[model samples]
Target: MILFVSGCASTYSTRSVEPSGFLGDYSQMRAGAEEDVQLIYVNPQADFGRYRKIMMDPVSVYVTPDSYLRKVPKEQLSMLVNELDAAIKTQLTPHYEFVHEPQAGAMRLRIAITEAQGANVALDTVSTVVPVGLAISAARRAVFGTHSSIGKAGIEMEILDAETGQRLWAMVDERAGRKITGKFDKFSKWRTTHDASEYWADLVKERLESLQAEHAASTP
Candidate 1:
């Protein structure tokens, strides 16, 4: 399973360009730059706060046909999907009602895991790298370039009007695994899949909350 650092939040910026006709029907608005940690596009006129219900589709693994994950056992993939779906539900439950199916006036959240790299935990432990220093170095490297050593995870999601199928928002983000530090040796460790899941889930929740607040304030 892939591992990722905890508290690794993605930074996002919004663009006001017209949606490119690239992603088929869902490309009403497209995000800028392929390398951004979080690329978000929002309909400038949409009132996000007005949507109180959401229908989340099952999380899908969209890796390449011949990707390394294809060789992984089926049970492992299922476990990852289950964890991702549960994490999303847990994060959104506090802010909106969940529906079993799409309905009028509701929003639909579609999510997919586009890429994942599993960590070699045994290798990480035996490797002579200093945990704290390596983590700090990794953070610095992230600002300059992509560094995928232990593992990584990538995700894409879209929010649309359930009835009209109008794209309201969309984002893509990815995070890399990092070494962990602590007061004692027991707690100082490498990142894990659970840590990655929590970080991404919390990032999504925070972004949604910010959008909701912005819309709420703008309403007359």
Candidate 2:
């Protein structure tokens, strides 16, 4: 019975990436939506309609032994986190008021970048080692959603009640860049990470909207 239940549950750690222990716990996470790439969990008691503000914590990078991003230069890692923060803020700012201190109606958000891998290790290292980052082409961004070889990245995030410590929602997702090579082959190692951050931010906003809708529908 235990094995059967375990088989039915979604696995957070995968061959391409593993949980960096940044989330602290992964026991409640399960298959998210119909997508295999996402693992998520939401507290049943969470009422999204009650929150009108968000407290976004600084984005963090996992540097433990299991992290693929550990070897990345500090500057590159900082860039990744900053880009992710900007992406998320852009998505959420329109829907919720941004707050610094914990208040009555707010949710605190936290994110951790777990993996960032480029297609060629030598080239990847060189790109980061140098001061100037590689320039990514618009064509590469279009192809990034399809074939994957140029790069890949992963992230984990959680939302918690601002006043209380209870977790409201959490998610883990990963994405890979395309294999297409040509004039666009030489791209930034953080390109996929940037794309994934945008995707996650969009999803988080959509999920919050849906949660609010659900509460509204059930209220009346």
Candidate 3:
């Protein structure tokens, strides 16, 4: 039992790009990034009623040993996307249109479930290095109501200029939900006891608003 609990207290880390000066590997990605842009329109959630999905599977890779990684099924992605879309739409509408490809015409916002992990990593160590600084994902069948939650809902959005194919802005967030343990037993789908999407959204919006203010401050 001690070993089992100790094993559960494991820790893992992973890193992903947060854009930068350019987007793609091609030469044009640099020059395309300098264009004067406008919001034109915004979709808090884009498709699938606001949440979009990519074919790439969600991966659980260990940043430590750096070898063990398993692909999460597309079904999980699909289910999570739908749940996230509904959650976001409850606050805001679809941010933009899906013109087929990113290079179709207007700016495209693609949301991919980059990462969705819910395993309990046992760690009494102070420096476990959580990528999102949050606990594991789990199911909690109560909070919002008495209904049972299937699993957690996580979403990551990348806004790219379709013409340039450059990712300008992006945000990754996860929310806690619950799955029915039995007939109605509920538990936190995440290791932590809070939905992180709201916090992340506010953080992103704060940065965006600050940048907007800076741009305005620098203008006239």
Candidate 4:
């Protein structure tokens, strides 16, 4: 079965940059379509799962759109961006053009997130009774078998014209809180995995790869 998934939002732990470095191949996502060429990067958001939800999880936080830098507690955002800048550069192709502003060139694209939180709740029976011997002495929080991810997050992207700012390609990446295991597909959500950093990285890699393939197919 064929599925359409879009990724836009990102919980960058680094400082924001101009996004100009990603110039090349930026047009392929909207190749053949007339107009100037520009690639815009959307700010990433963070979705949190509190309470019991945090107890069980896969990836803690998920970043959308992808960035060379991640915002952290105490660090220069630009510095962080530099660290991942190379990786991000290598990811984009050497053909497409990137523009910081929108114009008549290529169309525009937007990125967004959906349901970015989840949890695993193991509910127990809470009763109130004053029996002489052993009525309901006290309530105890027992660990039920095991509940996987019970929360979810999503993202979306849209491509528009550079000058007139017209709309073109659009995509939304979403995930339903589902239990995941091991590394390969490893992910972290909020407290479940401590900021879903690696998870977001993996998704970003996949997105870049997808863009590369599309660029090649559309290239003359």
**Which one wins on lDDT?**
2
Q: Could you say which candidate leads in TM-score?
A: 2
**How high a TM-score does candidate 3 get?**
0.38
How would you encode candidate 4's per-residue C-alpha lDDT over 91-189 as one tens digit per residue? 332423444454333433333322234343321111111232112222111132122233333333444444544433333333332232322223232
Per-model TM-score on C-alpha atoms: 0.73, 0.76, 0.38, 0.34
lDDT of each: 0.61, 0.69, 0.32, 0.29
Residue 3's lDDT in candidate 1: 26
Number of the candidate with higher lDDT, 3 or 4: 3
Worst 10 residues of 3 by lDDT: 1-10
lDDT of prediction 1:
0.61
Q: Please report how far candidate 4 places residue 166 from its true position, in Å.
A: 3.1
Query: Which sections of candidate 2 miss by over 4 Å?
Result: 1-17, 34-37, 121-148, 180-186
Error of 4 at 205 (Å): 7.9
Write down the worst ten-residue block by lDDT for model 1. Answer: 11-20
| Candidate 1 structure quality by residue, lDDT tens digits, 44-108 | 87877878899888888776664445665678778778888998889889988999777876899
Clashes of each: 0, 1, 26, 58
Q: How does model 4 score by TM-score? A: 0.34
lDDT of 2: 0.69
